[model samples]
Target: MSNEKITIAKRIAKELKDGDVVNLGIGLPTLVANYLPDDVDIVIHSENGILGVDAAPDKSLVDKDLVNAGGSHVSTKHGACFFDSSISFGIIRGGHVDVAVLGALQVDKNGNLASHKVPGKMIPGMGGAMDLATGAKRIIIATLHTNNGSPKILNELTLPVTAINVVKTIVTEKAVIEVTPEGLLLKEIAADTTVEEVQSLTEAPLIVSPDLKSFDVAA
Candidate 1:
């Protein structure tokens, strides 16, 4: 898992396209902002009611009232707008967002995501996951392939679901998988990971790419 976090972050970042409206969920999903290419004109959305969000702010520039959904202070571009949560969800449910990057505790073979609550642990609320999961045109899940050395990409989710069949891609430290009609397809794997190793971690059957190749950080 060398540079595992960075690797996962970069993998999600690469999926962004120009002019895309994106909502980056708390935690790992937020890292995508730091990696957006200069040429891309993607706009960031914050469910707390901000649009055209900027990258992380410097400590000196942090504003108590200007924060992302994760509660971290964030800066905004010149044209960014602040609105009510109701309007924000309208934009989400109205299908205005082109993509949503989410972090999941578990994602099953069918693209069901469990991020709201993991049984047996009291935690923060689900936040905007429900709206973002079903509303966004595309859902990209950014997470570790496993937790506590156990696979999180499962045959069936153990926790309650946030969304069903909403995931378009799964980016992890070990591999990248896309949800296809046939099933989850193994698009790529980390340089040192083997197909057998990845297969062992995934509960769903993995279909290796015909030209299967190793994963690498974009230069």
Candidate 2:
């Protein structure tokens, strides 16, 4: 993985509060598990029917039947429990998850998300993204700042929206942003990066926070 991905994961891990129940979406969002502080008591949920998820297990300990929502092998926490998808999604759609860290293809100024499919591309359907996006009490988008130099954050989504106006926070390699009723706010910038640099890669208008601070990735 690139340093950019690791940085995004580390920053997002800091957002998890004690006792929060979080659902980590597939792809980059899954990396957040590795960076979470051991002292923080948070339960990780996977839609495939595991709760209290821990980090990925070593290759030798991997179990084919025990995996996360993304189908990657993972170790279970001490109190972890297994159930069917019915119960898993019930926990999600019932508004029990405190936070959902999701990966996005595009996020608009309105905090809309587009991650399911690309136009004319083959996909395995939308999966549980729609439910998680709408059901979670808080949504945080964890993705790259850009896709091969093209801004993923835009004034408006160019693709089909996965969820409408549900995102609360966004963490990229270069910055941490908050979505509000007004617009996107720049909360923190990575060290050695500038507001101008972030803005240059973002299509939406960004309002810099008065109390903006440098993100300490090494922390």
Q: TM-score: which candidate is best?
A: 2
List TM-score per model, in order. Answer: 0.94, 0.95
Q: List the residue pairs that clash in candidate 2.
A: none
Model 2 Cα lDDT, one tens digit per residue, 92-131: 9899999999999999999999989898884657899999
Per-residue lDDT tens digits for candidate 1, residues 143-182, read: 9898967999988888998888898899999999988878
Over 4 Å off, model 1? none
How does candidate 1 fare on TM-score?
0.94
What TM-score does prediction 2 earn? 0.95
- How does each model score on lDDT? 0.88, 0.92
Clashes of each: 0, 0
27: Cα error in model 1, Å: 0.8
